[model samples]
Structure formats: structure tokens, C-alpha cells
Target: MSPSTPQRPRTSRRTLLTALAATPLLSALGTGTARATAAGDVYASNTDLYTRLPDGEGTDYARRYRRHEMADASTEARFPFHRTTVLAPHGGGIEAGTSELCLAIAGYHPATLERAQADGPVHDYWMFEGIRNADNRELHVTSRHCDDRVALALAAGSLNVLSLHGCTAAQAGAPASRPEAVVVGGRNTDFRRHLHEELRAAGFRTVDGAEVPDLGGDDPDNICNRTLLGKGGQLELTTELRQGMFGSFTRQGRAKSTNDTFRRFTAACRAAITRLEAGPDQAVL
Candidate 1:
């Protein structure tokens, strides 16, 4: 994977938010109990998953009425958004840490589009963006299947995308005791490696995406790289790392300042971006 050039100039954070506010949001609903659960993992089985919405109407209601998706969509079309776009597709009870990580990178701003679900039935949900993860629990669309609103953000002029995710250590053959390691992937090797180094400096263990068969991020067709720049990064953090970052072993706490480890991790992300910005022109792959 190589670094790709931005299709447009770097815009201010305010400008980016304005654009993101204009992007359209598609509608959906439903709830399915998760069969899997790990410490710090987010699954819809808990009652708290749907508690945030007005009247407890589930994730769809919040996305439709509370999130102001229509305004986000329309404004997003007006200008090139952030040069670096962060995403957390499995948040709000699917995968913890991811939404928080995206939010951290974006400085608590609405520069990210995180999936909010109390119940969205899905199969192989991680493989695609637009595919519904709720209702009937039948379809599993990959990036090859179709682009969702999140996927369409690439076309809105974001130069890069960084998708955050959480995974079980056992899934990667890692020991339960030390699950603080991370796996970095995506098409932008330079940026990916930079992130890897930064995380290492922050005292967390790391593995290149290529070294992990199950969590490799190099696949071009992977949802991570389906951005406007055609190159992006994906980070798969172990539950241990995520737990420390979120200051909770479950999806119950807020991302407060007390999460020192999480702050360090996000600092590394910002440092990586600064270093990359100083480098030579990236080729738009």
C-alpha cells in the first residue's frame, strides 16, 4: 500500500464539519441480540444500547431525527471535507473503542460517521458499509455489494480514511493476559506504519497488518480503502488495549479525560498525521 494524494486542499475542521453535516443519511431499523461477547465488547443484548434515543426508539430513530443526517449530507456536498476522514462502522454496541477512537481523532467533532445500532441484524457486518445490520438478520453485503452513506463520503473529497475497530485477542491467537497489541492495515503503508510507530511509542504492542492473516488491512477492496483517495488505514485493536483506552471492560463508560491510555493513543494518531503532512506529495492510487 502506498500514500495517495488528496483530490483537494486541506480544509479547516469547521469547514469539514459543515460539509459532513450535508451528507444524506439512509433510513433503517431492527434489533438482534449478539451471540458474541468479550470484555469491553459492545453488543446489543444490553438494555442500555437503545437508551440514548428519544423515547428509546432504537438507533434508527436517533439517526433519522436526532443526528440531522439530511443537513449533514447537503452541506457535505458543498465543499471538500477533511483531508483525513475517520470512521467507526461498528460502534454503539457492536464494537467498542472504534467510535471513541474516531471521535478522538476528530477532536470530538462530527468529522466521523459512526454506526449507531441497538438492533440492526447483520451477517458479516464488518465486510460492508451500506448493508443493514438490523432486521431479519439476513443480508451481508460487502464493499463489492454496494456503497452506503459512509462509503459515499470518499466521493466527497476526503483524501484519506482511517477506520477504527476492535477484535478479540483469541481470534488472532493472542493470549488473554496481554491483549494490548494492535494490528495495522490499509492501503497506505507509510501512514499505517507511522501510526504503528506512534502507538508503539505510546506503550502498546503492535503488528503489521500483513503479518496477521485474519486481520490484514491491505486488501484494496476492503471497506477501509473504499475512500475518495482510494487509500486509507485500518486499525484492529485488541480488547485489552480498548478496555484501557475506554477506562472500562464493558461498553458502559463515557470517554472521559481519565482514560490516559486512550489519550496517548489519540495523541499518536495526531502525531502521525503531522509527520505525514510534512512528507512529499502522495500519489493518488
Candidate 2:
């Protein structure tokens, strides 16, 4: 995808306590039972997956997160609270490239594992990565069914949640000639528009997720929309799009060998988040 000029178009809060209260701590619920499946996922939820998988820094699967905080008293006094949280519910082998993208979008260099800029803004991030040699897809828990306690808590505390996901070109209804595309969705219409504008301006093809109901992150119960503002934004990147962003598609390769495409995509996402932050606080209607 090459950069092109696109026509520009003009583009949540509240019930924080209610969302926090309504979200159950799935980790605390030790029921090993599986729920009825609409997605045919192997596990019922992140909590259920935890029961069957090994979780550690270097295990079959891992959960990682970083919540930015004030550097000092003066910084705390001057800086507004970070209101966005980036999420990758199906990262690593499950949805290759998302883990790295999550890190990059959260203001970190995937290769160096450092802040992208010396004084750049870093938003909160949460990732569930599958590191198994095979069958990693079994770790997947659909967005609507994602009940990871940490993921939920981070999202519920923030005014915005930007989730990264992966899908096939066919799933996105993109033609083979232009398979490298993204579907932007979610309940946060303003944030969604910002993403579309910035991504299109950056030359990436974007499809309206509304055209694909399953890919649309509009469900209020969807984890992405379970934020303080009760809405969030989601990006469903095509496999071709994600593969082109890295020199190699393996887990290690993705982190260590991201290309210009990767950087551009992350930059566009960060830009959209910046636009969202600059806007007035949303009311919890």
C-alpha cells in the first residue's frame, strides 16, 4: 500500500463504577465448565483457558501488560491521566503480529523493547500471546467472550480501548487483488473515524467493519467496548496486511524484524489515539 491523499471528514465517559462493578472477575470463578459455543473456540474464556494452559513469562501462553504512570510528583501534577488502553486478545501464534503491534501501538519498540521516543506518551496495554509450538489457536477466546480479569480491569478504567485483531482477506470481504486491508470497527464512532482517516492517509486500505458483522466490534458486551466510556475501537488486519509488515512472520521474527509498514501502521494508530485524547471527554449516556 502506498501513501495517498484521502478526503478528510470531521469526527465517552461515565459509568466507570458501573462497568467495574458489572464485570465479574472470571479468574476468581474456578468453575471448569465450558460454555455453549458460537465461535467453536476450544475454551470458554481466558479464565477457562488458564485452567488448561501453562502461563508464565516463557510458557505455552503468556499475559503481558504495562500501565504507564507519572514519572514524578511534578509530572503527576502536570499530566492528565492516560485514558487509552491497547489490547491484543489473540496474539502470538494465535493471531500472528498482534502482540508486536500491541507493543508498538502502546509506544514501545518491538525490537528494542524500549519507548519509541524518549518522551513519547505510553498508553496502557494488555496482551494474551500463544507461544506454543503448535495448536496455539486453541488459546483463542472471542472478544465477546474475553473475560481476562486484567484485560477487563484495564479497559474498564480507561475512557478508550483500542484492540488489534487479525483476519483473512476473505473474512474481510476484500478482493484478492487488494487483499492487504483493514476493517475498522467498534462502538466508538469518533475513534473509528480517526483510525480510518489516519490509516487511509497513511496509504493503507481500510474497509468498513460494519459490512462484516462478525468482525464488527460494536457489541457493548465485546471486551473492546467494555471501557469506562462504554465504547472502544477495533482494527481487524488482514493476514496479508500483517505479513507484509514484518520481514518474517514468526513470533521472534515479528518482534525483531518489523519493517516500515509495521512502523507506519503503528504510527497511524497512535495518531488516532492522540486525536481521541485531544477531544472532549465523552459522557456515559
The lDDT values for all models are 0.50, 0.79
Give lDDT tens digits, candidate 1, residues 127-212.
Answer: 12212333312121222222445345442345566766666676544677776777887888778879988989888788887877
Clashes of 2: 2
Give the TM-score of each candidate.
0.59, 0.82
Shift in Å, residue 151, candidate 1: 3.4
Runs of candidate 2 with Cα error greater than 4 angstroms are 1-38, 54-57, 71-79, 282-285
Q: Evaluate model 2: give its TM-score.
A: 0.82
The lDDT of model 1 is 0.50
Q: Which candidate is the best by TM-score?
A: 2
Each prediction's Cα RMSD? 15.7, 13.5
What lDDT does candidate 1 reach at residue 167? 64
